[model samples]
Target: MNKKLCLGAFMRPISLHTAWWRHPNAAPQANFDFPIIKDLVRKLEDACFDAVFLADHLAVMNMPTNALKRSGTITSFEPLTLLSALAACTTNIGLIATGTTSYEEPYLTARRFASLDHLSSGRAGWNIVTTVNTEAAYNFGLESARLHAERYERAGEFFKVVTGLWDGWADDALLMDKESGIFFDPEKIKPLNHKGKYFSVKGPLNIARPVQGWPVIALAGASDAARQMAAESADLVFGNARTIETARSFYKDVKTRAIAAGRNPDHLKILPANQVYVAATREEAYRKKQVMDDLVHVDSNLPNLSLKLGVDVSGFDLDKPLPDIPETEQSKGHQREWIALAQREGLTVRELAKRAAGSGIGEMIGTPSEVADQMEEWLLTEACDGFMMVFHSAPDGYDDFTSMVVPELQRRGLFRTRYEGGTLRDTIGLPRPDSRVD
Candidate 1:
């Protein structure tokens, strides 16, 4: 069978741009408005997007005090709560919410997703994250962030426990025998006496098996430890690649790891985050991107970038190349990618900062056909299985893709014109996992 492209909408209340809310067409208050979110999901569903991925942070993104206030990164609805509301309004589009293993308990996470899966009629997905922000530690009563290695270790065990809890009941456990007054088969239910290095979860999950067996597990981590976790568990891998070569490398590496883990590589879909600006003409699209680019306050972003990279680039001259600094322990994956990007392009501080301020991933600035062509090229080259599109503006950016690029991809038979199945797993071509209770 030919591979059809899998598209997911990477949604935040605001765009990747710091000044996105200040855009003339942007709705600055959309983050607090459910009606607007509802509209966005409806449009994505209409566009035949496979899922709407909602990224969450337990605390405001740690940035300079002024920058935090200037940026819209701080304020947003809780992901699970928002997704639950969205599930009530949409029929087929998958609702993927980020849940962190670092801060949340396995049993609670399991229950929330199970309920979401049932609420969305099996269209739910969980984007497992080991929350990265150090400030979040304080909120959870810790003084500092967990070590990266330890976090991923906890995450691996967390995944095991959650999936085990999801498998608490066999698919046939719920008989609902009305005449006999038997609610379920006790023999078919099992408790997960999961004791691991990081967690001890004893359960028969309160909820029955999710409609799709387990809600689809979506993971994003670029580290070796992260890759191994994805290989062992993830159905979808949200990748970060700035170029096709890099993307292909990541795709091959993860698939190889999956095979080594005794799983079929085809079951793991690699979807890189794609930033696109589409217009009627290529010139128009570039103009649209420039408008957002012009709004960027480079100085405001420097402190944040410095903190992220683990070396202060703020003192360096804007036109000078980055000084060789050791990678930070904060985010090894991002540190490696940012440095590679700078070295590859010989970018100056100003140029790199500008790039950081904009969407920091594979980007396409083109007309509808041009964008479609690029997407097709990437898919055919095996650079990625699909794309998780991050729009420049909400509703408007989303409107443009669905109106322009979606049709072009459909015309080329690279994307679906309608949803293929009821559950997200089915729509994404993943098999329903058998219950692991036995």
Candidate 2:
């Protein structure tokens, strides 16, 4: 049997390029416009994408004023609320929303995902993210950001508590018996009574067991702690490797770790994030990318560089090569990527900022056939299971991929022409988790 690719769209802000809104064909307000988002999602479903991954931020003023003013993501609907609305609009495609473990309560996170799973008829997934933006700490009533290790530690425990709550009720727990005045089987439910270093929760989740037993568990990060947790629990692992070699290595490492943790490695699907810019011709694709790159303003570029490096680079001399910088408590993986890129290319501060503003790991830039070729190579070579595609600009960029590239992939027999099943786990070939209560 041949391997099939599992494609997911990284949506919410709707585009990944910093200057996406400035594109001539871009929908500037699409991020906040429900009608636009609905249409885009519907198209993705039509193309048989696996999921729409919605990223979130708890703070609006996380960046400098100049950068904030130019950001399309600063004003957008919350992930769960938007996905819930989307659930009503579409069917089949997974609705994945980011829920922070550092600040959100376990019970609430479990309940929200369970509700979404029920609402979407089991086509829901939770993207577990530890809050990395320091400004988010303030919003959550913390004076300072938690240390990197501490945040991941809390995330591990948080996952256990949430999954435990979700498993509180057996699959047949609710009888809804019309006779005998018995609504449910009292013996079927289990109380979590979870006590952990970071959280304490009493089960069960008020809702019935999710339609897919538990919603698909998805996690993203490159840190060691992150890898460990994903190996132990995540059904879908979003990777960030930039090269085929790097991606293949990451795929092997995570799967190896999963086996070490006594898991079936095939249960963990790894999809590296790729920002794609496709066109009718390869030259046109590169030209479009260059056009988009030119639109990135200095205001947004520098601040993004600072954020990625986990240091304020605003004071650095733009013409000078990046200086030696100590690591901060932000995302170690991200910082390493940026530092490595700069060193490899010997880029100056200004050059690095420009690159960072338009950067994404393994950017696919070419005609539909070219893009399809790259994806096929990655899949066959064990570089990744598939891709979490981040489009360069909204509406047009999305339309191009679906109308152009998706068919190419299907024609090659590397992707599905139709969805395999209704739930996300089925679409991705992951098994539905059995209720722990059993």
Candidate 3:
């Protein structure tokens, strides 16, 4: 009875799996692996996915460079660069990439996406991120990291400016009027002249309004301020929460705010992160996934857990109770959502983390039917518009699901059989915006 939601993959350019290089079938040698990704895009197209989303960070992770490299998830290619290749390879599936608001000026960021939109014939989405790494601060010439709240504030303003700039050039502004010797209608162009708290920019973008009126703006936010930005400005919001109840709460929270802000509640689509695994039987899938989970450093993960929880988990026994760590203004907004799920489900902190991790894929894992049923239930209850599929391991991790599960989804009639049209907006069923100057 509900509009079956769409699907998007959350990916890195090269690797997403730590043991991917060792996956026997994994492609370890080709980090440039554009062909491998082309196959991936084709697979998504086969399954009628709306888009394939790419995530990025601006620096080498602070961990030992070799260790990070061993993880095979070290910085790969720049997202837009790789996605451009994807645009050439696949026809219908949307291409989404992460470009940070913290480190980039809006003009360049806006132009790159607009260009990709054109290249993809409008099949493009932009994942807006205000990154969390400290290393990026130094690389970008800042002496210190801005506080998380401050970063979000800056990010919010940047979104406004970029969207504003996208509108500065009117639909008819660029005409090759050789007879009149005018390349553009100067009257149709306006300078942004924006002087915001964080950024000052001027003038119309060199690129015209993209095919989608602009590429779809996706917000991957888990913090409260971050969620507000998504609700206010995002066409799609990506979240990595662990349970349906938690997902529902988040979905409702955003919709409520969007309504108060005079935006359509339906305009804000909530997509919780779901990591998935599938097989002929649930038990075999479970066993295989546990093996992959074991390769993860259980001990090393505690520190990251601690940082998110705002409590040191180093001393806490995996068998003991998780200490109460009050949520802070600048951190752990996702954990706040996690804690709510734990309380609702009567789960221990360790249990919660394990479920998150053990889902073998973050928040979504199971046999094909089980995973599909859960997804449908979430949709029926209004918990999410769809999932941003985060592959736990690269290549084969996604390959396995596409091979095993996507067809099952097709049989169920919950997903599309083919892409409806060109352009990411058309693929996602969003109407293209009319060219505007206001």
All models: lDDT? 0.87, 0.88, 0.74
- Highest lDDT: which candidate? 2
Sort by lDDT, best first: what order? 2, 1, 3
Estimate TM-scores for all models: 0.97, 0.97, 0.90
Is candidate 1 or 3 superior in lDDT? 1
Per-residue C-alpha lDDT of model 3 across residues 1-438, encoded as one tens digit per residue:
647777888767443444556555667654557777777678777777888888887877555443454555564778999989888878888899999988999989988988998898888888988876678889998876778888888998888888888788787787888999888778887888999888889867888778787789898767778778887888888876676776788888988888888888877677787777777788877776777667654443544455456555556656555556676533456667555666667766576555443332345567788878888888888888888786655567777778777777777877777777777787777766666663
Write down the TM-score for model 2. 0.97
Writing each residue's lDDT as its tens digit, candidate 1 over 1-438 gives: 287899998886446666777778888887778898899889989998999999887887677677777786767889999999999999999999999999999999999999999999999999999886888999999999898888988988898899889988998998899999999989899989988787888898999899999899999978888888998899999987888999999999999999999999889999998989999888999999899888877556686567547677767888899778785557777778888998999999888887888767779989898998899989999899999988888767888889999999998999998887789998999989998765
The candidates, ranked best first by TM-score, are 2, 1, 3
For the record, the alpha-carbon RMSD of candidate 2 to the native fold, in angstroms, is 1.2
Kindly report which residue stretches of model 1 are placed more than 4 angstroms away from their true locations once superposed: none
Better of 1 and 2 by lDDT: 2
Error of 2 at 31 (Å): 0.9
Stretch of 10 with least lDDT, candidate 1: 299-308
Summarize candidate 2's per-residue lDDT along 303-355 as a digit string, tens digits.
98988888999999999999998978887777877888888889999999988
Model 3 residue 409 lDDT? 73
Residue 144 of model 1 has an lDDT of 90
Clashes of 2: 0
